[model samples]
Target: MKEFDFIRTLKKLSPLPWERTVGNDSAFFKLKHKRGLISKDILLEDQHFFSSIPADALAYKSLAVNISDIVSDGGTPRAFLIGLGASSNHFSILSALFESLYKYARQWNIPIIGGDTVYSDKLLLSITCLGDAPQNPWFRKNARLGDYLYITGTLGSSAWGLSKIPTLGHELSDPHIKRHLYPPLYLDFPSLFKNKIHAAIDISDGFYQDLTHLLEESNLSAVITPETLPLDPSLPPEAKNTALRGGEDYELLFASPLAPSSRRWPPNLQKIPIAPIGKIIN
Candidate 1:
């Protein structure tokens, strides 16, 4: 199928609010009251993933990474624009990709509005996700001196999975490698935590590095007890070191005054494991 044909299928599957005029010069989106947020992420062949990875997984990751950004700011994704670069014979792969993309869009209630496509040497995808914030969005700069530093889900699991990707040959069934290919999404965090969180960020660039970003933005320092840090039980000692430096986990790291010990999370989030790794220090 061609680009236009695939786009038409997307409109049929999950049409955007303004998709009636999508085929024109540009797409249009409008919202009242709530603030709009947008984030873009570029995934490339070899640089981001091996060619052995399946197209559907690639498509999901492309959209999920962008959604991670929206979630970090306490927002709900509304729509997305996809810029695809691939060769002629990639139509079948593109079909599988669109199927996965549209499926996730419907599940998230977001639409694939519009984008540009071109022929490239290798498969390249750039996704721009747009979202709406119900209230004031969280930012790293808002962290308070006494705020607790927390992480949702496990860290370094993705790195551990990445290490095995070369040996396992892009196998998604393996639990370890699967984490690298499909990082967990924290969409419910914004809704569950609500306005309690003062600052937030997605751990796309590993724990320590992204933590540094948070601290830098807040003009504060933090003390993270290595022993308290959450590591995958399956990871070896060597993997622990890589987990701190490795990237692409997509887990959320937020600063909040809410005491994790005193509060009981909703039953649905108990399985995800939210833990305090450290506390901000002036």
Candidate 2:
């Protein structure tokens, strides 16, 4: 079975209460005085990334992706726990990873609360992120028939960067290479839009696949205008296909009745382009 099919089977076996929240970007629950959101992600060497990737970049991407999950769910990240598995000989790498991890944690003001570490033959990293959720968190199921589909930032840069890794290891000065190493975080997006968004998902598994998740959950279809797709301008014309199907952009894909206009966005958010590429349909 495919990854999503396996996930569907697991969701079927899950308890009734959790089934409702099981498939979202983040799991939501009530906290003492506020709603809480949580998500976890794992990365393995040679699979998700190459061994030659800089420790700092690896650490940042690992933690940032989990934080993306929280933000996609309309939450502000608060803290995280990390699990690391590496052979003892890689202590230097571990040290650099932790240093960079803590640096970003301080930069983002999110704390590293707790987690476990184990020795393994291969390098592995896992992070569980916690956040304060909005009263009504965004979900894949909340899309409406007339909502416009919008995406933040450009697409395909990361994929393009990945293709260059074999030829240019650790040469992150290249913008595309840097994008692959460190994805831009949309930490303030949730708070900025708040209740304006109807549905949301982060583009981790390519535009087509991730958008399909929202459509399936919302029981709707979309009509995309080919011209409106926000392909990375830096990529060549042939890379248009990569923008549509390549994964790991980590940008926000959301639905709303109102089309997003740069004129209305704050200066900071304006720097991150938003484009309406499609709309929901029956």
Candidate 3:
């Protein structure tokens, strides 16, 4: 069965209070004084990534994807737990991975709280991120009809980078390759657009597919203008399809009531070029 089909089956079995969190990027629940948000992501060698990938790159991407989920929901990540399944107990690889992971952890000011490790036939990484939820956290179901759809940064760079990896050998010097390996994290986005964003999802599974998730959850549709897509100018004309369907971009695709030209955004955020690509429709 397909991934969504399996998810649908799981959702049916989910408990009443948790059902709403099943399909969202992060699970939100009440805390003593403030709400809490949590998300988990798993990466497997030869599946989510290649075994040839460097330990540092693999570690960074694993943490980044999970953090993206928390940020998309308008949460500030507080701490994370990691579960590692190693095929072999190689100290060098493990050390490098943790070194990179901790470096990013310090940079984000989030701590590595705890987790477990196990022996396996292949390398596997599972990250569970916990964060402080915003007053009105963004959700896929919160998108309203007529809300404008906007996307951050560019698309297709990660996919383009992946394609070149076989030839370029994971060189971080190439922008595309670097994007595929170390996706740019938008940690400050939620704080910047806190009040304006209605719904949001990180573009890890391609723009079209992830947008479909947002629309489905909102019980709405959308009308997208192809020309409005913020495709990277460096990409070739033929890369449009890749930009639409290529996964692992890790950029934010969100809905907002404010028009693309709305001056309601903060001055600093105004400088970031968020493209209005589509609008939620009936």
Candidate 4:
């Protein structure tokens, strides 16, 4: 079957509100009353790149940023589109970047159907990934006051690692360095929903910003215990505050009630284990 045929068969109605697709062949589907419009835009600059980052990994990171948003809402990535800005001197570097994109694209079984390019003095790139939700996309606003909160991985290390340096120009290749480079993507979210989580959202900006989104979405307030939040092992004792507020961890922060047997929640779902850091209240 054609790719479109495969997509058409995947959509299903969920209890949450969602926009209807005109057809699977269309370019993008919009939010009728939903926020999960596909093709999320993410921008990057020289500061965002490192000389040691492989093009494949850069492409993966670039693409993962957008895909993270879609999948957090239970959307399936269908393809990608890019907006490129670079100079004649950097064409080869940029070329390798996109080559890296295709690596994950193939791993993800997605397509790069369209994009635009322009000349600039330096590098600036944006990736817009198209994804579809089988059910209504998850929203941060729906977090209820009594719901239990969870995160897919530890926080703080990505920025924490970026803040520190090594001697003799040797880059650290430890877990913290890997966390800084490639964050854990919650690809197994379908299994997470089996436990009846109340509402969900992914952490993007910083914990404060993300938690604000959850409260905004649910129309509730939360009191999170700092000590209970998952912290990176590599974080300096002082960096604990940064982990609380530093962003770009890209892990899923979701809410669920304590299950009859919380034991059933997957072992890989969290790095530090899902602790009830706070309670949603009016």
List model 1 lDDT by residue over 37-58, tens digit each.
Answer: 8999988887887877787789
* TM-score for each candidate, following the candidate numbering: 0.90, 0.85, 0.85, 0.77
TM-score of 4: 0.77
lDDT of model number 4? 0.64
Candidate 3, residues 1-282, lDDT tens digits: the string is 532243234324422322233355444443434688989988887888877788889988989988999999988888777777774434447656766777778888777665656666677888998888988889999999899999998899999999888888979999889989998788888788888899999998999899999999999999999898998888877766677799999889999999878788656865456888989999
Give the Cα error of residue 110 in candidate 2, in Å.
0.5
Off by more than 4 A, model 4: 1-36, 50-53, 165-174, 258-273
Error of 1 at 203 (Å): 0.8
Q: Which candidate wins on lDDT?
A: 2
TM-score of model number 2: 0.85
lDDT (Cα, 0-100) at 54 in candidate 1: 84
Task: Give residue 80's lDDT in candidate 4 (0 to 100).
Answer: 73
State model 3's lDDT.
0.80
lDDT, candidate 2, residue 271?
A: 62
Model 2 lDDT per residue over 1-282, tens place: 532243234324422322224355444443444578999998998888888778999989999999999999888898777777776556557667777877888889876665655666678988998898888788999999999899999999998888888998868898988998899898888878878888999999999999999999999999999888888889977776667899999999998877655354444566678888989999
Per-residue C-alpha lDDT of model 4 across residues 148-209, encoded as one tens digit per residue: 77776788887676665332111546656666667666555744564356667667687788
lDDT of each: 0.80, 0.81, 0.80, 0.64
